[model samples]
Target: MRIVIFGGTGFVGLNLAEVLLARGHEVTLYDRAALPLSAQRSLADYGARLKAVQGDITDVDTIDALVAEGCDAIVLGAAVTAGEDLERVSPARVLEINVMAQIPILQAAIRHGVRRVVNLSSASAYGAAGQRHQILDEETPCDPVSFYAISKFTSERSAARHAELFGGDFLSVRLSAVFGPWERPGSVRDTPSLQFQILAAFARGEPALLPAPGIKDWTYAPDAAEAVAVLIEAERPRHRLYNISSGAAWSALQWGEAFAALHPGLECRLAEPDEKTFIKLHGGDRAPLSVTRMADEFGWRARFGCAESAAAMSAWWMQHKEWI
Candidate 1:
């Protein structure tokens, strides 16, 4: 299958691209700029199953043509990341980049006879506080507090509309905090969050950040990417939204400490806590639209489980310092 990925230059996209290529699928990456040096080097090592095309998301006709050129499906992974300066970025910019940009692309794909589209959604759409492991699912009400979350939610709605209005098949996956190999340095590096801090400090040969409260259900990137590919290959579903995750909880410190134990000299220490940073973990009643559905419906399962995957990532990063 020929699959097209937007924003395939970044960390998650790079991992996804590699996985798709390894599976013997032809991959064309559409991005505004050339891939980073590391990505280029890795692509060279991985051979030519993958290729890159330069294009802006704003170019509707170009995107249409690309989709029409024997590409069976579209995977929308492009988006401006979360920002600290929300006001400066503005809600308008978020809508333009995340929401509006996806519409013309999806419309063009439908017009050009693309069979399916996999839109990447986010857990942040639940808003500022979680309902104590509320088991946030596809049916949960959206109360997006951040511009990034709002944009992701709005994009999913737009994709669903495209599916309903134009007969285009679509699957939107609400991904949780995703981390694994091929992660870009500086993106999560030095992050105040306990897990990343520990990972980052160890990477830098420093002390890991140890904290009890920073928790998240971190899906492994390769696993997450595999889920996206599976959804694209599946039949159109009555239920269009699914949460792709490990669906398990762990503190940032727990993850960091475990990784730290793997390597000597790297150790973890607690930093001063910030009340605002605590995540409201969702609860059990919700039964997050399990990837078990993907498994049952499409024969999908995580290639790597959470803790083992995190350790693999740490070891991979440690060995390939040049890649980071």
Candidate 2:
């Protein structure tokens, strides 16, 4: 199968690109930025099976031509994450990329006869309602608080409305707590991940300190990529929206302990109990997204838990230190 990832050079997109190639599918990554030389060298062995191209996703004709030229499906992985530290970046740019950019992309997908379209939405769409867990299922009403959250929810609605208007096959995946390789601070995903902090600190020969309240259901990159791969391969999707995740929550203590055990000197410690940084990755129900729908419909489930993911990611960063 031939698949095109719109933001293929970013962290999640790069991981997804590798996974799709491993599945023996031809992948063409379209992004505004160039991939690092290290990543290119690591994936060089894939040869013609993998490709990275520089293109503007907002360009309708280019997308239409690319999709019409033998692309099977499209995965919309392009977006500016939550906060860009406006002092160093523009504020409205986030909304511009996350919310407004989906219009032309969806139009091209529908017009080009693309079979499947997967829009990468975030759990933030639920806003403060499900921040503390609340077993935030797909049915939860969206009350987006932050600009990033509002954009994500709005993007999903746009995709659904477009599909309804044109009778096209478009879907959205609400992903939560996803962190792994190929992810770093960039134009698309600017937030730093806990895994990267731990491993990067180890690489710098220092201990890592994390915020309090512990995080849960952190999805490893390879695992998240594999789940998306499975979804893309599904012939007929039962639901337009599916939550792809580990569907379990864990604390920073678990990951910290795992790192301590793996590397003698490296430590993953939580912040002071009274520290205002006592941030919770999940809320209410303390559960991430429920993968029951994905499992039932497409036989997809996360294969890695916190412990396994920690160990695997640690080893991976060790071998690919350039990524850290």
Considering every candidate listed, which one attains the maximal TM-score? 2
Candidate 1: give the clashing pairs. 132-282, 132-283, 133-281, 133-282, 133-283, 134-282, 134-283, 135-283, 210-269
TM-score (all chains, Cα) for each model: 0.86, 0.91
Poorest 10 consecutive residues by lDDT, candidate 1: 277-286
Q: What TM-score number comes out for model 1?
A: 0.86
By TM-score, how accurate is candidate 2?
Answer: 0.91
lDDT of 1 by residue, 1-89 (tens): 88898877766678888888877788888988677776777678656678899888889888877877878888898776655554254
**Whole-model Cα lDDT of every candidate shown, in order:** 0.70, 0.78
Error of 1 at 3 (Å): 0.6
